[model samples]
Target: MKPGKVKFPATKKGYDAATIKDVLPEGAAPFRRRLNQEVDITCIEEGFYGIICTPHDDMGMVMVVRSGDDHFPG
Candidate 1:
């Protein structure tokens, strides 16, 4: 997902911090997603990204995304 290429639409809930340290790739900036609004994300780095809704994080409102091809060693 290139920078500003991917769009995240918040139809039901919004995200407070989209990129958490250690979980997202380096240089990935944390962004917010307002309710009923859309936001763009930068996933140019090849790594795992963790997205969470600050207010609903305790309720298990979280997601994980992998930006690159799976190249696990055999």
Candidate 2:
């Protein structure tokens, strides 16, 4: 859950946000090591899809998808 204003989706409060990237405070690099990952999904229905992450995390190999074959351009 993020510590700030702005209504989040999912939970009633702001406890329904995804942690996309992890940008720690400056000079705090010794706390945790950085890693990369991705998520795959198949869209059964159409609505809203979201990709959330912490600040400062690099954008590589990360994917939040809506499952469906119709979404593809063939």
Candidate 3:
């Protein structure tokens, strides 16, 4: 793979990112990933931040978004 090209697996059921983003209601924030197949997003704090699981095994995943309001997912 190159620096930005994505190679989707043969088992994926969806491909349209815009359609997925549209599924969320207005004012809702979304975190999109192109290469991630099996992701686990979790709220690090009660309602402050969330983590996006990385493909790397040794490297730790970090918070990709932080929110104090209802815009972000719980």
The candidate that wins on TM-score is 1
Cα lDDT of model 3 by residue, 1-74, tens digit: 11121222325533212113333334544555455243433332323333333343235444334333444544
Q: How well is each residue in 1-74 modelled by candidate 2, as lDDT tens digits?
A: 21222223332222223423332222211121123422222323432233343332254423343323324334
Query: Higher TM-score: candidate 1 or 2?
Result: 1
Which stretches in model 1 have alpha-carbon errors above 4 Å? 1-4, 13-17, 70-74
Go through the candidates in order and give the C-alpha RMSD of each one to the true structure: 3.3, 15.0, 12.6
Model 3, residue 26: distance off in Å is: 17
By how many angstroms RMSD does model 2 differ from the true structure? 15.0
Where does model 2 exceed 4 Å of error? 1-35, 55-74
lDDT agreement of model 1 with the native: 0.67
Q: Show pairs that collide, candidate 2.
A: 19-53, 20-52, 20-53, 20-54, 21-53, 21-54, 42-67, 43-66, 43-67, 43-68
Off by over 4 Å in 3: 1-32, 36-46, 69-74
Comparing candidate 1 with candidate 2, which one achieves the higher lDDT? 1
Which candidate has the top score in lDDT? Answer: 1
Q: Estimate TM-scores for all models.
A: 0.67, 0.24, 0.26
lDDT of 1 by residue, 6-70 (tens): 57776665445455556766766656666567777767777667787777878997887777773
